[model samples]
Target: MSRPGQSSRLLICCTALIVCQFVSQLSQAGVIRDKLMERRAQQSEMEEEEAATNGPRFKLPPGTRVLEDVAYGSDAKQKMDVYLPASAGDHSAVRLPVIFMVHGGAWAIGSKTHNKVVENKVARWLPKGFIFISINYRMLPQLLAREQAEDVARALAMAQSKAAEWGGDPDQFIIMGHSAGAHLISLLSTSPDMVAQFGVHPWLGSVSLDSAAYDIPAIMATKHYGFYDKAFGTDPAYWRRSSPLHALNTAGAPFLAVCSSKRPDHPCDQADYFVKRANAIGMRASVLPQARSHGDINQQLGLENSYTQAVEDFMASLSPAIRRHLE
Candidate 1:
């Protein structure tokens, strides 16, 4: 009933409306696709960063024997490399103290055999008659921070059960970890009850190497790296549960938190806070702030320097036998 010009105008309006809706939907889809691609790129960069930290494969030191790929759990990633001293021969009755080490890659990517994780420590400790253990646990996107701590506990329990076979004294165990691994060890040290559930006995002490994640709530409360969001989701209760500072209720083990002063994130401040809380609860805890990079804190730990001597001094304080070895 309308004029031809009016009908044409009506059709044009309808076409414009439809085009706008289609354009809006396309824009939304493009936004979603861009976000996903950005996430993938971030993950790729993270993996590359972790890979860069991995130096050459660890070369076995003379007179040290390593039992590689010792499975602690059903998962392929749940394995450990046990390095024994020469004194642990077939007929030797020597029971060496064990240094159980956990490597770090932001709780997502790392291997037990990473050279920085095993090389220097093995060179230094193996000659001193200590059994060194480097472990690999299921990483993020599969297991979160709390579950990762549980994996460490499981590995410890398995190692303790088989200590005699490797001529290691199950009673003389010291837990050590770097970066994210440091956070896990710190959590285990603070939450002895949780670890006890896994049949893990009390360790001699723990050495946390430059862990800023001791207080998860504190980190998440402020500006933090995106990876923390991945490791600790958007749960306040989970933050408290995963935080080492929040988990400390009783004195379980002595602790040494070695932090990097060079880091802008103030890892030493977190370490200080954790140590103070531990000391308040009658636990022997201290923080060592070194003027070094984060990577150097872990890499240069066993070299013949003041830094290594300082760490050795801490280990020496754990037991008279350990003291004798360093002396």
Candidate 2:
């Protein structure tokens, strides 16, 4: 016993509920879009300010040339700064090896020029006829760690394509990074699939400075700390894929893992374990332990300290002059 208009009323109520749900979703999306725009705008402004102050911050040596903000991808963060040495007699006939550096900020925040480290590194190496390149990649809570590794690989691919134009030897590029950058570059070094995916060139060697994320499963096996869960989640499969240690199966390029002796359970422990695994697989690898803080291990590099000498020894091993120097 229903009223004549009862069915019509029921249909009207259902339609109103659906419309309300749609409107609510639209409102939420708009809020997200607004927040994203704000973050992007802030990042752009900070970079602009840094650019304004660059002249005083980066003092170049005589016969040095710097090419800044060369784009590798469509994203604003996909850019690199190249530092070239002064022209020497018959230098054009011989392309020099490139030092490709990736900066570290816990996979969240960092730039190619962070802390004037790149400037110092450039001033030191450009005089020695090395072309130094620093890169910037898209950061997190926007992209995951694996995706960031892909970005690094893409940057390498692009860099190799343009290395000769910038006086760099594409076939002899060396990859180096500190902290999170170390993690990303390690993946590029170990993961053959990733290298093939991104079309990276055959790099000479890799230097990982104080990176703890080489063994992601081991890190996850213990009590987790800040930023680990964020970059790598609770998935075991993903952890294995992200781990550089796990990625090593066959003989690959040589690696110099310079770690902070003061830090526990990482960079040191991981470096030792990685070297063992790498050697077991017939790869040339070694760990250099230094008595310094993790930050010092990065910032104090290229200052010709004992630690710097150790790194140089590793770099020298990779050089074409190794046999000549030995002779």
Candidate 3:
């Protein structure tokens, strides 16, 4: 028979093993949930695209059309998709305004294809001709955060140069990205000088940064950003380089900074710091009216009437020059 002390030790060991197993299972479950959300978002996107021609009932305007899967690159390796209004009767010669849509995946696992909903919604649903370009850039483990931003910058430059081919005006380039993609575009707007290192022009117009992690250093406190530990070291200087909060200065893109109320619970406080910094330096900056969660902000961009008056009103406030140029 086993001694009581031996039994007690065995019980403790078994408990430890079970606890570890439970943690591992929970981690796996979290990953599965993430993948499922991504997959569903993609599925809804394809369905919406297929249904665009039907009407507002299908959540799209009839004149709007998609120019799927175009490869916008100076080289063969880089590619992107542009969704546009089909050559409707009189608008054939007109070049529409363009928003380059960047999908978020925490700087690691997202695709241009990941944001199909936004691509279709913005491109096909807007009554005024709005062309959407979704891009895939080199991401984490392979290149990390800074490189991911570079990929977006490169894609934007290519989009600007090649806009005419897709019936979009080269002058009006809006960088709209969600979550990590929002973070990437925010960095591009605040630190256009960073992309100058890559020989790309700073964007001409507004950056719609939706649910972006503005304060990356602040975000690093979360477990997921810990995954960034290897690339962005523990040092404040290194972390600052990746944070949009640190990059807010007198220069860069005019910003339409949209944050979800449900995320960070106090985005006004969190986003205010960056918005004020940008404004104090004379960079045009404004906040979006809607108070959506991070997921809701991006998720809604794929559907109609999601933030109806709020987002549309904000877009309507842009410079008439941009509106006319896009039209």
Best by TM-score: 1
Evaluate all candidate structures by whole-model CA lDDT and list the values in order: 0.86, 0.79, 0.63
Q: Which portions of model 1 miss their true places by more than 4 Å?
A: 1-56
RMSD of each: 7.9, 12.3, 7.2
Flag clash pairs in model 2.
Answer: none
* Local lDDT at 47 for model 3: 30
lDDT of 1 by residue, 210-290 (tens): 888889998999866678899999999999999999999898788999999887577898899889989998999999999
Misplaced by over 4 Å in model 2 are 1-56, 88-91, 321-327
Q: Write the per-residue lDDT of candidate 2 for residues 205-273, one digit (tens) a residue.
A: 999988878899988888545467778878999999999999999777899998887754446988899
Could you estimate the TM-score for every candidate?
0.84, 0.80, 0.70
> Which TM-score value belongs to model 1?
0.84
Tens digits of per-residue lDDT, candidate 3, 57-123, equal: 2244556665554565454325676666555334476666777878775565555654343634564
Give the Cα-based TM-score of candidate 3 against the true structure: 0.70
Steric clashes per prediction: 0, 0, 1
Better of 1 and 2 by lDDT: 1
